[model samples]
Target chain A: MSLEASFADEPAFVPYLAAGDPDYESSLAYVEALARGGADAIELGLPFSEPIAEGSTIQEAIVRALEAGMTVDRYFEFVADLDVDVPLVCMTYYNLIYQYGDEQGPRPFVRKAAEVGLSGFVVPDLPAEEAGPLRDACDEFGLDLVFIVAPTTEGERLERMREQVSGYVYVQARLGTTGARDEVSDYTERSLARIEDWDVPKAVGFGIKSGDHAERIVSAGADGIIVGSALVDIVAEGHENDDATEEVAQRLEDKARELKQGALRGAGDRPRVE
Target chain B: MSTSKFGDYGGQYVPEALMPAIEELTDAYERYVLNNEDGFIDEFRQRMRDFGGRPTPLQYAEQLSARYDTDVYLKREDLLHGGAHKLNNALGQVLLAKYMGKERIIAETGAGQHGTATAMAAAHLDMPCVIYMGETDIARQRPNVFRIRINGAEVNPVTTGRGTLKEAISETMRDWATTVENTHYVIGSVVGPAPFPSMVRDFQALISEEAREQIQEQAGTLPDAVLACAGGGSNTMGTFHHFVDDSAVDLYAVEAGGSSLSVDEEAGVAPNSASLSTGEEGVLHGARTKVLQDTDGQIMESHSVSAGLDYAGVGPELAHLVDSGRVDPVNVDDDVALEAFHRLSQDEGVIPALETAHAFGYLEEHHDELGDTVVVNVSGRGDKDLETVIEETMERDLSIAPDMSIFREVGGGAL
Candidate 1:
């Protein structure tokens, strides 16, 4: 009876990669590798002319993706042909959505996105007020409009956000862009506590570096974790060598397994170093 | 046939997404301009009279002319709505869009003048309008930003590229590509693809159309030379059109050179946007004339404090004229432009846009050359540039006399 329960038991979230930095065959293989891993969900990022929030690592990934001639329609094509076993979320900017969306703007993009077998969408710039049109369209199309709540979000905004959003809440651990960081702020601690009280599933991101960070976030209250810059860095490192596709996939799998193992171990027993 | 073939330089170059719309524009422009239809001209001319507040006056700059020993006639385009000659073309495009049945309008602007004007027109017609401006421009020109928004248009801040005019154009192009089906891309200047360069030139050529008759009645002959600045070459070409075939009237196009000309920065290079000076005859952004590019054939971006002239290329028609020895192009440094800005403000009681100061700079350079007569296009007023002038003057005064002790004691100094 619970359509969402089926996905609840699904494996940990897996982030997909575009192969050859942009090479078609290699990228196709990379998507398959992500599916082969215990990834319950896959996030496929489409290259855009501008990526405002993406850090250097993901920016480079996009450059390679673009160099491989990736486009809005081509991303849809890859999704259609892949036959991968997981819910797919397209992570991208609002510019591409604005360009490709319908007369009302982002809503049109969300509607068409639903038609293309997409399970959800994650847009950085579409704030909650602006997200309404997209949310309404997604509801009509039966697609999830995933929203992001940063550590700095207050009670009023958080309550307002919970009423309209679905799928899951992305809890940003730090104030800046998505990348590895040396320290976590007290604001992040308060936010994690606040997110733990929410009814919906929570996913922590931003400065989430290794398996330990993911494990700590999950044990704190996160149902899952999203890793981008760290995974992108590994992919970039592998790109310097001769067969980067499989190697990068192996590296991602190793990290994913580590996070999964850590999730089971829990962060409660670990001494509070902070 | 004239070497200035509108065909070679006025061809279209647009992304595949907006090809249909551009092609339609080309067809509509040709149909309207070339057709012997009296209805189109009647409507266009009537609008210019009633709505556009034309024919703009041609006042003799008695002080400047006497100062330089030349009979300087000033074409007063700054009085027009939106405060520049830019409205001449904006009115033309808005009417054209109405005829074409397009429901929405999209445009790009720097310094927010053109965007402000376009927003005015769209507001008048009750058409939905979207304006893409560089984030930096939006901040610098915040007053104009609020003006356009109040006029019922949305301003989309473009954060890409160097966050200036060129980036704004790129954003506009991208938006046009997507909304081409229902939107009319109202290019702010005489840049972009074919028909646009020529189209905007033709609309703005009204400056010369009236000036020619006025000059003949007053001076008993055509002026010896006509000078104007060449930012996107709109005003320069608009004034130069009537005299292109006169053979006796010399034409000079001055470009911006900010600060010291010899300063290593790309400030005031004579050929900044002067096609003949910096460009090889190649296609760029649609128009086939001269474009500024590197040795590897990539477009070399241009820089100027004046957003209007900050482009890498000039209109191809202007390029042909400069190349064929018909028009002379010169560079004007920012110091000269600032001086001219002050002179025009103090002496004439009119503030000209920094873009138009390039022409004023040219007049300063050739003060001795003009023995008898000259006419300069006072393209736009400097209301938009008060901040620039004040800031630049303050900087100069500070550098000249930085000692706080001297300034404190200088309360006894003369005003």
Candidate 2:
């Protein structure tokens, strides 16, 4: 199934987690729970050693993932092994994608990802201007290329990104790295308003934590809500506390259901605001 | 307008969040730096003269000249303010930040040389400054950490990814993304995404600008070779910029080879920082450059006796120059660099940083190949490396090393 197809009928709930974080076995169960809990599509973080765009939480998660021996080859194997029905997206630094094949370029990685059932990608460090190589490769492989729109993004660069974005537009609700926050940013509505005209679905990410955060973002006119650190927080707690994998997976399922229901409530109440 | 790519080497590989800031900085770079808008270059030169102590002498090394059988000249960047070439770019960027009305200054440091330089510049400009340093570096480079704090800058230890320059840069980048609206990140090298690599090189190019003029005045010709140690290529580019166009003048970039060029793929560590010597083309620190990485495209942990030259990646422009045959990339191992450190100190009365010592090591090995007049950039002083030197010196029995019987008896650094 296409990644954007999840946003067709209702407000989508997308949760992100680092594959092989703490270890391969536990993380897989956590991700499977998110799918069971109504995740429209899932973003799997292919951990890079230097995650420059990440906040402390996700940075630690990536470090743990790497410590657990997650490599590019292993990440693809993990993807293929997943039994989940929702479309998956690989989010990582541009270097891994650009250096995957022996011939040098993004084609080999794109080809491998397509074979593993990945629907799209979210390379945080690959700006739209330098994305020609990756974009062309994705086009040949029939994979979606998602572009993130920061709150500060606008003008010609914004237009350029919108033109290239395929699966869904990652709408950064604020000017910051990824992490869960106590309060929803005031810029969410403004960021959504600026890109409201784009034909693609907009999935707001960064600083999203709870049901209320998801509800507010979707009500702010987002087609979906992308949460990473919040759900990753549960996984982190599981690893730190050394809780059973099934226990942590159950929490993730409950949290994902809460976020999904919140988005639905927002979608149902959107018309009442007018 | 200066293009971003230098023969398919440099391009902006930063995240979409940082693109606006990068674009804005690019515009500011063009206006103030390139066009000299509002007399930015004039003021920059004046400040460089009065504050930074510009036009550091190009002194002939009498003892070294006799030993090498060639007239060896030293471009004394070590004599500049903060005792390093880093102040040139630090002052330029801090002043530019003021011009852009930025309220805060942020930077990352590996061995604390660039951090101290940036702190001094920010203090002089009366801007708030914060430096991100790896926890490992903070513990090792105490004096420089003290210098940065004394200059009224906060040093936040980044305790991730082996606690080195690489992690510190990632932490600083994360900080810039959130606070880019009001904060200016003063990248310490000519390695990051565009405008940065070009802009930092432009600021540092004054080293060559003066050396080129000084050589013509004193020696009546451009030197046969311009040599400088390559870390992230700030000082190397600065030293080589003017000499690059002079076809007769050879440009050599000396890199840190650590213990050996051989890498441990299982450990994911390159026992060298010679990216230009042995690396693959990949994106690192927001630029497409030659980097020390594994087959999985993971950046490996790079090693060097000199903390400053321990980065896994070289500047894209420097990589391009090496690829196009305009410049040569060579390396010296830790033992050789340590010997060079003592050699220059005893021979020329100059205690060169371990990073700069690599160049002298190369000069010692390849003096016969170089033509008569050679100008070597003394990138920084060695006061900051005293403790590291004492410890490393204890491990190796060097013929050139000074007698440290008392230090050795006390188990290192009691003096």
Candidate 3:
């Protein structure tokens, strides 16, 4: 229940796309493309109306995603049918899980997820104190309960999080809602240092646009990088351009590696490991 | 009557996530009615009298009545503790929220009337209260800002959207999504999610409910017409609810026209807040209602001198009532409303808020038509607007921007 395996081998993580902005089949192609583009793992986003912490870009994408008829069961079925080589992570809000679980617990989602070959779950709002029941359920079902940490997180909680947190630590690059940003902030650099101190393989997200941004997060000491809205935006824009799904998927894969390359370059600039 | 139909107009156009909440509210209200007998109504009245300072007297405006040709009866909802008729609905929603296992109360406001009332009710219940207001409104309604804070409620300034009612509603919705586990969003107006539209009407129905019985005792018969200004149409609906079913009663909802209806786009009505008079059918802030929009469905700007009546859409239920001929919406110009405010202050010795002045102005026109009998709901006192009015009058030469046409029917002058 740790990132020990994924961390040992550097692999590309892809973001699952929903078709149309609110369209369905378009998203199916998006997932296929990401898989074809060499995505090591995929994260499927479940859309909700009040995503309080999401930026306008992701918010709109979610709206589009939901409009495309993205549902929890649908995502599971999509993964089950696809010949995806990578592990799958389902990203959703607490309400969806609560509703899916009948407000009882996360056992329902975990059980359904296991049946669908889903490897892990990422719920951004679930604090560690409240993560226990879900974590235990995930453990029972041989699924990982992925926890996310932000730049402004306190040190004690970060350490406690490092000890109890399963799967990989999702280290967000910056603060202020989830979205795409143009430049890396000094705050992100400081946060990377904090994540590095935990000595765990951290996957940095939030505003990871180009390979360069991805490179920066990696150089900042991240082992894996999660690219979401940028990839979703690429797919959305590609759909508008009438570009082939494979091309869009290929572009996303290229961008992920490009970001990784930038991080590698930055890593080379870091003081050498003994 | 408006073109927007409630039967046809008030359909659920919300996201699937909100449907359950709406259903829950509808169910709760239906159950409340089944359990709420005359004894329950009497108990509610007793609580309002003992705690909320109700049985708000009907003040006779003899001087104004003499100045005009007809006798004017003022239903003094402004005398209620919290300075407006908002308390009636606040008590109802807060009590309902308590029953729903909601430990916290959230509200959105433009004029702070509803915010203040909600804060007062929340304080009374010792519940945590959060009010989302536009940053712009927070700057103008300082007295209410201080009042809510003093009463142990947090005022979260919403800087998003147009920074008015629309923005406030958006923020409140966002808060509700996260806090839904322990929170009930007590919308001030008779708008928002379905249950809110229905729930708020039931609570504020006290105004017309008591007025019907009380007016019957005073005048020996029902009045010819019931008048109140429409800003989300809460106060009007509150007083008009009991009368809506009364075939003999005429219900009139006056909208702020900002002095002249012909002066297109000069009035600064916060478009998202104004529902009647100008708003078209559209979904906004999570409710299907009347919104002021352009040909392309883009929301248009709204205007009114009073912040309270500055919304762009009327409540969906009110829209329905207006469309179904259950309620009539009349637009009032700013000049007429201001004149009414001054006349009421000088003659009746009761300074009325600009929003209430809209109803006062409507009454001023209909006194002759209605003969001697009429009841107008004075929604709020005018103290908050004294400085603003005085400043505006003193700086008469200051250039105010052009606003949207206030009246659908143009005239020579409002006075």
Ten-residue stretch with the least lDDT total in model 3 chain A: A11-20
Per-prediction count of colliding residue pairs? 6, 0, 40
Task: Point out where model 3 deviates above 4 Å.
Answer: A1-274, B1-5, B37-43, B259-274, B397-415
Q: Pick the candidate with the highest DockQ.
A: 2
DockQ-derived CAPRI band for the predicted complex in model 2: high
Clashing pairs in 2: none
TM-score of chain B of 2: 0.98
Q: Could you give candidate 1's per-residue lDDT for residues B1-415 as a string of tens digits?
A: 1222464455544432344466678778878754624366567778778877889888888788777878888888888777888888777787788777899998888878888888888887778999989897887777789988999999999766456666677667766654566789888777776668778888889999998888887787898888888877888889999899998888988887644323222221322444445555544554556655432233445666676777766787787788778988787866677778777766677788888888887898886775466778888988887665555655564332224354336533321
What would the per-residue lDDT of candidate 3 be over residues A1-274, giving only the tens digit for each residue?
2334655655335454433344556566667666665555677776654454565566678766655656666666676776656677777665456446444556887888788887888776555544676788888998877767765565565665676676777776665456677887566667667776665567777777776776666666667777777877786687678887667767766765565566556667556586
Worst 10 residues of 1 chain A by lDDT: A1-10
Model 1, span A1-274: residue lDDT tens: 1113323742245454543354666667666665665556766787653443455567678777766666677777777777676787877755456446336346666777777788887776455533566677778888876777765456556776787767777776765455666554344556768866676666666766666666676666566667677767766776677656777777777776775566545445345445
In order of DockQ, best first, we have 2, 3, 1
Give candidate 2 regions above 4 Å deviation.
A272-274, B410-415
Q: Model 1, which residues run further than 4 Å from truth?
A: A1-274, B1-8, B36-38, B260-276, B280-282, B397-415
Instruction: Report model 1's chain A TM-score.
Output: 0.86
Q: What would the per-residue lDDT of candidate 2 be over residues B1-415, giving only the tens digit for each residue?
A: 2399998889998878899999999999999999999999999999999999999999999999999899999999999999999999999999999999999999999999999999999999999999999999999899999999999999999999889998899899999999999999999999999989999999999999999999999999889998999989999999999889999999999999999999998889999999999999999999999999999889999999999998999999999999999999999999999999999999999999999999999999999999999999999999999989988988888888988787867764453
Question: Model 3 over residues B170-191: C-alpha lDDT tens digits?
Answer: 5676666445557888888887
User: Which stretch of 10 consecutive residues in model 2 chain A shows the poorest summed lDDT?
Assistant: A265-274
- After the best TM-score superposition of candidate 3, give how far the Cα of residue A82 lies from its true spot, in angstroms: 27
